[model samples]
Target chain A: MILNIPFSDIVFYFVAVFMVLLSIAAVSSKNVLRSAIFLIASFLGTAILYLLLKAEFMAMAQIMLYVGGVVVFIIFAILLTSHLGENKLSTPISQKFLAVFLALTLLGVMAKFLFNTKELSESITQKSPEASSLIAYGERLLSYAPNGFVLPFEIISILLFMTLVVAITIAKKDNKEEK
Target chain B: MLPSVTHPIGDFVRENVPNVLGYLPDFIQPYIPSAEIATLINIIICMVAIAVVGIAPVPVLIYMERKVCAHIQCRLGPMRLGPHGVLQLVADIAKLLFKEVYAPKGADKFLFYLAPIFVLTAPFLNLCVIPFDKNLQVADLSVAIPFILAMNGFGILSTLLGGWASNNKYSLISSLRSGAQIISYEISFAMILLLVVMLAGSASLGEITASQSGHFWDWWIFKAPVLGLLAFIMFLVSSTAELNRAPFDIAEAEQELTGGFHTEYNGMAFAMFYLAEYINLFTTSCIATVCFLGGYHAPTIGILAIDNILNFVPGIVWFLGKTFFVVWIYMMFRWTFVRPRVDQLMALEWKFLLPVNLLLLIFGVVFLAFGWILP
Candidate 1:
């Protein structure tokens, strides 16, 4: 759809700026809460870009699942150390060497793959069709035939199942606590 | 339907903007609402809006609570602060703001501060998808209820974490009880939700409200009476527990737990959590209106097709009115109601509410199969 609005471009630039600011905050905040909040800002900024591109469902899903579910879960986990973790406290375990080294190596390898991929053909960009996220998602979700949801749908479900099991096991009642 | 022009900005520069100066602005328009980007911007707007809306109710509702509580108790209550003690809430907030925010000695400091912000930002973010007035929503998505419910569930994280992070035994104790109550109640609440979704035959909030229009008795609550009544009752119980309001306010049983989970918090951080608790008050009300009360649907009339004509009044007002009513009802329970023990709260969720929600879900599926709603 042609959005003839004169200032949509201005907002897009703001979104980009917001993303960078959030990334910086996420990386640099010594306070974990602040970092998580910045992370949420990053996700929300990304979701807006998604909406601007007419991908409303993906935007909402990013907010709902990632920000709402995943981030909240992580924040709560941080709280697990709440009683004992009140200050700008540092962890005793110093794995900085392995962590920083592996991170740079991974980034380099990913960049290499992006340049060397064999399907280095022309980029494909399609304008989004107009449909509400819920409706479109349900339709795509149910379509498992010729043009199907066979792979991705199953993968999503499998991921959800694994997350469920992992969460329950980790959070399950500890036998030692019972004693 | 509108035609889309995917032409590069430089190509359209001559047609739209007469100057090269407007180049960058023209370049950025087309890629706006694609996916993550639009949602991100919309979420930020919603978060900011919530800060204003969320805080407003903190003072207003606190004063209102005092007045209401006084009436119930046959006393005039505070008449000194502002008009009829209207400024009482303002005074209270002032005191909380100036109060020394101390991380008690030996307290794990980071989680102590982190807890309040976690509890607070949630309500702001959740408010994004709600349509208060038709054009006023920051983001209108089809999966609004699920989105709302999911947020409602996630907000509990802040509550539990806030409570546990304090390291005080009282706070830890409150977190345990509150966490279990929330998780258990949510199961029943979710079941009730599936039932309503089935009955509506649509997942989008806008479509669900649209599907319920007709005469005075045409609301979905009136359409599927049993399921509606059951869902409404269960939703009420769960929301009471979810919001940690009276009868279910295990998080702050001062007599026993010394302000429950918030024992270690003070100052502005504490105030944020306090304000957020009220935002949840309004958020849950909005969710209930969207799901069971036919949202912003106007009642049908005898002579005029009132529902049809009233659709012009913007879907937001009816939504607000319905939501306010729910909020008021919940508020009455909060201020004027008697408290329930922790065990009773647990039993209510596990025994009474869960079975009702299960039954409602089953009926909803059957209703869908019978084609009671439009495909």
Candidate 2:
């Protein structure tokens, strides 16, 4: 069985295990900063999984956005807050149950999706999508034809612009108040 | 459509390096698996090459910076170590290696240990995608630009972590400053690179470098004339801030934050951060060389004899020369300029550089649209 196993499968399983461990560590850690670091590690593991799947762009985006931007921002918030990792947080039993229930439901849904999707199963058994170059990726992202992401992309850009404007306005108001 | 490298070193590894694997004794070959062994050997060779290329110059760079700063200040720097103090860094490194490594009380032990390592890895990760020469890059990933940006984010994270883990107020404040500065400047840095990508029509570093493989004027710094020059200057400014050098080095301002994020680090751990900084300096200069200057491509005048002679020199030499020239500029800035206030640093990036970057990007787009690229 070991001889029969493909090298890629071994790498995939290794990354999956690593990610699972990291996620567990993140959720179970008492120190908020430690949890955040663990979360970054999980994100990094996900990036490696993307690389294994030959989704280079997805991997880079994973690192750039989640591990790099979101987690760092979270750490900044944590550092700036009054309590710096000294909080002995305890979840109420009811809330913990609810979390578990919701988590199980989500896991079930994801598992169902994975097992029932014939296309995904077939694609996984075969070669995954060919690694597309950035040129093609950009073209598809900006193209106006069917299958193009242009409209949604533009909408997202507008949304981000609004968010930026709101953030700036709020920040400026706070500054003026302080002044 | 993976971008192809014209002179990829991978072929050399495949054709030549695997032969050495064949000499393995028959007794060991069956158990070890020759094919896997070959791949491992190839990977090791690549890693060694990357480490050598990315890290080996750090000592020399440190020495060079010291010398340049001293000369600029009209002082003799490190004259006793060796001839012209060439071995000064060697002695310094030895001292660092033997120093006590310790974490302060109340410090996060794990993070305190991990921070230097994480920070050190960022530049090496960045060096992977940089096309030093046509064949010298470790991996020419299609998402090289984004990868580099992500690595910059990684660097910032490590800095923040180092500061927080230090359990020192000065370290925290300095790291906070560093995080803010780097995150702000990163926007301009990414924008300038994006402008280059738009002109080159490819985000792959290898392809971008290949696109400029012609006359010197064809380089991105000259190709679009005013906009190109503007973009290059903006890149330099933003990258200087990114590197946290003088004028923009408000993060580790000695007058305020004692040793910055690395205040708690000692011994080789401190040296790791130091080495990472210089490596990052080299990597950024290399990026500047690849993007703005003709990467590895020799500059040529129209004179046939001169052009031929220039072309005869290898691309790696030209690549290193341009990179070091940019590095020299970075050193000059550190010594010559006065450090700005933290508020001023923020203002400079958010107010001045950001707008200029956006305008330059627009101008670059317009130039490209009108076919006004200089030949």
Candidate 3:
């Protein structure tokens, strides 16, 4: 029997495999800065997966916020704090062993849950609607309906504004104190 | 199913490639699947086209920069290489490519090598979404505007990584400055882009251009009168700062940072950074043209006769003409203005541009909602 595979399936598997591998590398890398850079690679892999899933808006947002904003911020912090040539950044072997064990156990549990869910949902999967457009996502986000995200969106915005305000106030106070 | 070739240039090339391939032996031809061959050829052609658009103009732009600067300073520039020293850039490129690729002992070898690749890729990827002419775009993703923003945003990583990997004080400081400056200006830049998207009621670059089609007056810069004009100016200013072009180029202030984030880079790696910068400048200018200048559209003042005459000219020519005009304006700014100090650059973004941009965005939203924009 011949196996006929679609192009998208190939891309999906490629991205998925890379995403998992990069995520592990991101967590396991010795150098903190290198780890941060690896995290960006992981983020990019995830973005590609999003693209393969045909969620272009989410893919771009993933790159913009995760790779562009968060990862850069992480790199900045790493650069400002770490000594580049020093070998002091690596974790102890015992801690590394613990991390690997915990990761494997979590993966096992997730795999079990995923299989069970897949078995349960296989019958109903075809009834699921297609992914909504970005416009629909926006409308849903701003909607005040029963399942709307308006409150969460507003709360998040307010929280962000407060963080900005507090950050500026603290920075200004530091400047004044220095003066 | 065969993909319909919509672009004139693409169609011309597509029609010719199979004929060229047909001349090869039957054994060689049968070895390659027809579908795969076509797809491969198309991909190659696309990459070449994009590279030509992104990289081919760098030499000319560099020449223009030197000439413009020299003329401004009342000195003749590059009169030796070719006519008016046009080949000067060619010589410089050749020299740079052959020059030794160097890394300081303290540099992070991996990042030091990877930084230039990232820097070069960012601008080239960003070029994919630009509607060069109607149907000439490589991809017209529905989220093209955000995609462009995201790709351009990733450019900061190159500078940051390059500086960090160099292990030089000057490079580190400049990279930090670049990171901060780019992030700060991106807010205002995004605001301006959002204003444009709202006006057009679409985030797709092609759709945005389509909405603005018709007379010169229909261009977004003039479509909403005061608000559109302000948004254009805001976009121009913010984008200039975003690109780290002077007078906002504190990141690469020669006296302060030596060669800036790329201080340790030499030879082809340095050339990559230079090429990326020029390509980015070109992309920004192209985006500005597309967003505000009605893209490749000819100015039609509703006069049918003149409009007909104007339409005789193909769109790609108009696109290039308008884009170069914007590029010239940017070149003028580089030579004409003094570089701003870092503090002043921050203040300009935070104290002035941000507030003004936010206000302009509100105005734009209201106007758009009220259907007050020009037809």
Candidate 4:
């Protein structure tokens, strides 16, 4: 029997494999900066997967926010904390066997859960009939209806505002102390 | 055969290729999938065309910049290099191509090589969305504005990677500055673009252009009058900062950074950065043209006779003319303004442009809500 797979599924698997590899590299990299760069690669791979899923807006947002904003912020933090030229940046593996055992057990549990979830497989196989246009996405995001994201959106905005305020206050306090 | 060609340029080229290919003999034509071949051929042709169009103007733009600066400074510029330095860019390109490529001892070899490719790809990818004529755009994605912004955002990585990979202090500092500067200005830039998107009622470039069609009064700049003008100015300022042009060019401030993020780049690698910059300049100008300057539409101040006459001129002409005009203005700004300090640059965006853009966005939403926009 011949195996039948859609083009999008092929793209999805390709991106997923790369994303997983990049994620592992990101975590396992000895250099902090290299780890951050690897994280960017993983984020980009996820963005491609989003594209394959036909979520163009989400894909672009992923790139714009993750690869652009968060990754750059992480890189900046890495630069600030570490001497980039120095090679002795890796952490010592204090409990290597215990860590490996825990990681393997967690992976196994996740695999078992994933395989056992019938609803998850069903959802994966059945593509959504209606693809929301960008305008509809915007409307739904701002709407106050039952399924609308207005509350969460507003909450996120307020959270961001509060974070900004706290950060500014802390920075100002530091400047004052220095003075 | 190709489902009724909408793009005149694409159609014309598509028609000519197969005819030309026909002379290659029966074997080649038979092997080709005749129905799907036009699209495949068109895609290749467009790729080549966009690359050519993107790069071909660099030398001319560079020459124009030098001459403009020279005239501004009351001096002769490249008088010997073929008719007021027309061939100067050619000579410069040759010099750059032959210049030795070098990497510092501590540089990350892989990333060091990759940075220039990133720089070059961003603007080239951006060139695809710009609607030159009614159907001339390569890809008319609905989220053209966001796509362009995202591509540009990715460009910051190249600077960051270039700086980090170079392992040079100055380069690192410049890259950090660029990263910070780009991210900060991007907020205001996106806000301004959102205002256009809101006003146009669609995110597609073609749709925005279509809405602004007919007369000069129909153009967004003149349609909404005060709000339109304000948005245009805000977009210009934010986009200028986004492009890292003066007075927002502290990232690569020559006096201090000595070439900034690309301080370690040499030869063709350096040229790639330079090429990307100019291409970016063009792309930004083109966006401004499409979003604000009524794109390819001829200006018609409600005069029927004048409008008819204007209609006789093809759209590509108007589009290129308007885009170049904006490009010229950007060039003028580069020579005219002094560079702002880094603090001033950040302050300008966070303090002034951001608030103004937010207010403009609010006003645009309100106008759009009430149907006060022009038809």
Candidate 5:
């Protein structure tokens, strides 16, 4: 049975296991910094999985946005708020039980959402090479046809801009009274 | 016919590189997966070639930087080692290799060791996507632009980890500054890259190079009107900031922060950061060459005789020539400009570069919409 499996299948299984282990390491590590690093490794493992799935654009985006942008910001926040070279205590039993319950609930919701998406299942079974091309992705992003995503894309950009303005406003407010 | 003449060696190598597996005995071929083995070998060979290209130029770059600095400051530099001090870098590397490798007592040992390795990996990853010649790229992903940008982010991660793990205040402060500066400048950098992508109509580096294939004026810097030149200048400034070189070297400002993020690193670990800096310089210059200059395409002056003569030279030669020229420009910038205050650095990116980059993008869109690009 193992001999009958293709090379890509073996790679997929390996990457899936790697991601799971990294996720566990990330959650269980006592050191905040180490956990952050483990989280990034897991993100990178997801990127490799995307590559194996032939979603080249998505893989790069995953690396760029998650491992590069968001995690860096989170690390910065951690560095600012916490003392360096320190580790946190392990979780208590009650806290662990609560965390497990929350995680299970989230997983259940996600699973239900995934099972209900007909197009997602269809895409999984019959992938189109052209759908993964950068040009097609760009066109779809900016298009306003029935299946287009231009509205949501523009809305997201505007929302992000608003958030930036608000953040700057709040940050600068402290400086104004002193002046 | 011209391409055939110019890339004959490249074509031959690309064609035959995959057949190394076929040369293995049939008995072994049946035991192993031939296609997978061939791919693995190809990847390994490409990785080694890229590693050599990334690392082999460090000494030359170091020598050039020293000589350039010496000349600027009116002093002799490294005159004793070999002719013109060419062997100085070799001596420096040997000394670094033999030096003691130890983490600070309070340092995060695992992260401290991993930081240099991660720092060195970024440049190699970035270099793999670059088209050194017509048929010489290692991996030509559809999202090559984003992939390169993402690899650059790794540099910041390394700096943060290295600094934080060192258990020193100066390293931590320097790393924080680096994180902020790189993050800020990255926006402008991405915007400039977006301009080139818009002009090329594709994100693939190969396609971007092909888009600029024509006369000397067809290069992206000269392809459009004022927008391209403005974009090119912004590219230089933002990339310099991204590189954390002088003028943007506030993160490692010797006057304040002792040695910056690598303050605790010694010996080979320190050498890795140093070499990675130079390698990043080369890769960024290569990117500038490919995106703004004509990539591997030789210049055509509209004179058939001169153009034909130029075409006879291989693409890699042109590629390297343009790349080194940009590298020289970077070295000149390093020696000429003074480091900016950290606040000034932030202001420069947020107030100046970002707004201008957005305006250029708008203008570029307009120009592109009206089909005003140069032929």
Candidate 6:
């Protein structure tokens, strides 16, 4: 007897497959626009999974902001940056081999780690994990751990501030060279 | 002024809904066939609530506008139609309906007509998720805000498509302005939306409204002032632009872009767009209430000891009260405020509003991590 998969499960699988395919195409495609579009597809697929996981906010974050803003910006920048020089960006076999080796090794290590740990491995088996709502997520993020993750949160803020400063300084004309 | 008159809608609702357990859908309704019919009867009534309540607002809104403008300008407004011109809108609608629709020589006949339908689709759809009473929602989809946002897009597209199809140069310019302003504001509007999503936990409109109930402090407006404040501002700016209202009303800027997008449309074809514009104002206010202010939850005036008794107040009353206050705020901001230039509008969005919105989002997340309150 054949077991019937739930509609949601089938949808989740289809999205996952589509995401993997799009991600591969994102890396391999020669057309930059095609790559950006593929990346958006991957982002959307991931967002659907996030929605299925009941992380609605994160799902939209993936879609509206990341896909809508960041990807749109990247595509626009790429368009603005000029499309004339395709040959200049082409790389050789040695760089490709090195990247392939690094990726394969990283994947192998992750696969091995998954194989080794039973408790960590079991958690990965969950298809649909019950997650917090936006409010619940908010409260838990803030109030759960006694002292809270206040230090880390503050540090992240500082890091964001420093990054902003550095980005502006770099984006501005080279001051040291000018001096 | 009456301190706190518990609204009449709740009592009206109890009379409408049979309280007996048999009136409910499960087992109790089976013995008495009439009780079984009550739930179905309520569902049918629930569906028509939009038709009954939604269209009434357009006429009432017009009357309010007239009264408000009259007061501001120091003039006596329409006193001719049934008392203080309450039926003035009804007369206006009757006149508008019979007027001959003049299509421009250059306009695509179908799309020019279709624009009105597209514009009205949003307000009609807004009626879907609005919780009139506890069980009175059309589609309590888990993702109502996004659904509403999607509906808003359709409304924006109508203007764009309408202008483009007209083949008129000024009309095209107006449409482009509408597109630019609405699309740009949507990003920041969305970031603020995410902050609300973060606060409320769930995207379901009902969940967000329910979160605000029982007490004052539990309301999201007080939960995180930053989130509420940022979302409020973004919703305000975006809704203004979305409705094509000033100073973002550059779409219909009479002096510069001529009649802007509607330069080609006339008579009944034009009236549809006009009707839609007014309806959109109400839609945005309703959205603002749900997103930033807890929709329909009463403001702090007194402590409620018997909470079970008070949930009895029809949800629609809260929905309308919050919606009206927001609409009033928007009207004040528009008319009382000086309009900015188009360049300033774009700059305000890209340079100032967007960055502030982004920072507010991060702040919201940080507030969450600090054990600000129990979720």
Q: DockQ winner among the candidates?
A: 2
Candidate 6 residues B133-230, lDDT tens each?
56656656566676566556656556766776687878877877777787778767767776787777777777878777656666676677656665
> Taking the tens digit of each residue's C-alpha lDDT, what string does model 1 give over B1-375?
011122243234324433333354757656443333333444454456657766665666666666777887799988997678877777787898789888887665666777787686657666666555544555555666666665664566666667665767888778767777776766666666667777777666666666676654666666775657667877887888888888788778988899978877888877877788888888777778877787766655655665567766776677777877787788678776678887667656655576556566667777667856432
For candidate 4, the docking band is acceptable
RMSD of every candidate to native, in Å, equals 7.6, 2.8, 3.8, 4.5, 3.8, 10.7
Window of ten residues with lowest summed lDDT in model 4 chain B: B1-10
Candidates 1 onward: DockQ, in order: 0.16, 0.50, 0.41, 0.29, 0.41, 0.05
Give model 6's docking category.
Answer: incorrect
lDDT of 4 by residue, B58-84 (tens): 877788778887988999888898887
Off by over 4 Å in 3: A119-130, A144-148, A158-179, B1-40
Judge candidate 6 at residue B101 and give its lDDT. Answer: 79
Which candidate wins on lDDT? 5
Where does candidate 5 stray beyond 4 Å? A85-87, A104-126, A161-179, B1-31
Scored by TM-score, the top model is 2
- The deviation in Å at residue A138 for candidate 4 is 1.7
TM-score of each: 0.71, 0.93, 0.90, 0.87, 0.91, 0.63
Output the TM-score of candidate 2: 0.93
Candidate 4, after superposition: displacement of residue A47 in Å?
A: 1.2
Indicate the worst ten consecutive residues by lDDT in candidate 1 chain A: A120-129
Please give, for residues A9-90, the per-residue lDDT of candidate 2 as tens digits. 7778898999999899999898998999999998999988777666778888888899778998999988887667776778
Give the per-residue lDDT digits (tens) of candidate 1, residues A5-36: 33445667889999998898887677676577
Local lDDT at A95 for model 3: 93
lDDT of 3: 0.83
lDDT for each residue of candidate 3 in B1-375, tens digit (9 for 90 to 100): 112336766566657767877888986775444444556677677788889989887877888889888998999989998888988888998899899998999788999999999998778887888888887888776787888888876789998999989989999999999999998888889889988998888888888999989889999999998888888888888999988898888899898989899989999999999999999999999999999999989987788998899999999999989998998888888888888888778777877787687688779878888988886
lDDT of 1 at B238: 80
Residues A1-179, model 5: lDDT tens digits:
13555676788789899999999998888888899999999999998878766677888899999978999998998788666445565677999899999999999999999999877544332476568777888899999999999999999989987775575566556557868
lDDT, residue B144, model 4: 83
